[model samples]
Target: MNIHVEYNTEQNRCWVRMDDWRVAFNTAAEAEQFVERLNARLNAPHSWGMLSDWSPRPGAKARANLRCAKEA
Candidate 1:
């Protein structure tokens, strides 16, 4: 897998790209920390998986609504 990092001046954010996956962070340090965690998971002996609960948690809907509003 190849990773690339770039800063977007217009957005004033840092972005990290891994193939089709790209995520933006508020700062370069945050982006770097994300990369480091990802690297650690990839290099670990055991396989790591991502699990999400479909059941709602406290404030989950509110957070989702906020994100949707921000996107709009």
Candidate 2:
């Protein structure tokens, strides 16, 4: 997957745009640091996960299953 990260310091925010998904974060950080710095820098939500499955195939039913927790 491709992720485009853009930062707007004036607004104290960062945006993560992906081909099939999008999410907004306060600042870009390594996985470990995201938790440590999540509260201070976050004006809005620090991060959000976009649903990649927007629609189902003709023969498939739409469903979402969180397989497991990821590091970040």
Candidate 3:
């Protein structure tokens, strides 16, 4: 998964995107720190594969498919 961080001039805030998750902060520095902490947690030796661990499981897949079907 890739992480994206950008500052929004119109809103005068910072935004962060990771996969389907998005977050906004009041300041660019706060956004940068959040991204840094996220990277550290993900890259730590004990949680090397933490990203993959968030993947939907079999039951979650079925629920997601059902939700999608309903939305369609």
TM-score for all models, in order of appearance: 0.60, 0.39, 0.62
lDDT of 2: 0.50
lDDT of each: 0.74, 0.50, 0.76
Model 3 TM-score, 2 decimals: 0.62
Q: Tens digits of per-residue lDDT for model 1 on 11-61? A: 899999998878888999888888887788777775234234322463765
Of candidate 3, the 10-residue stretch with the lowest lDDT total is 63-72
lDDT of 3 by residue, 1-72 (tens): 789897889989898999888888888888888888889877777654855655455576556555431133
**lDDT (Cα, 0-100) at 1 in candidate 1:** 75
Worst 10 residues of 2 by lDDT: 63-72
Rank by lDDT (best first): 3, 1, 2
User: For model 3, what is the error of residue 9's alpha carbon versus the real structure, in angstroms, after optimal superposition?
Assistant: 0.3
Comparison by TM-score, 2 against 3, better one: 3
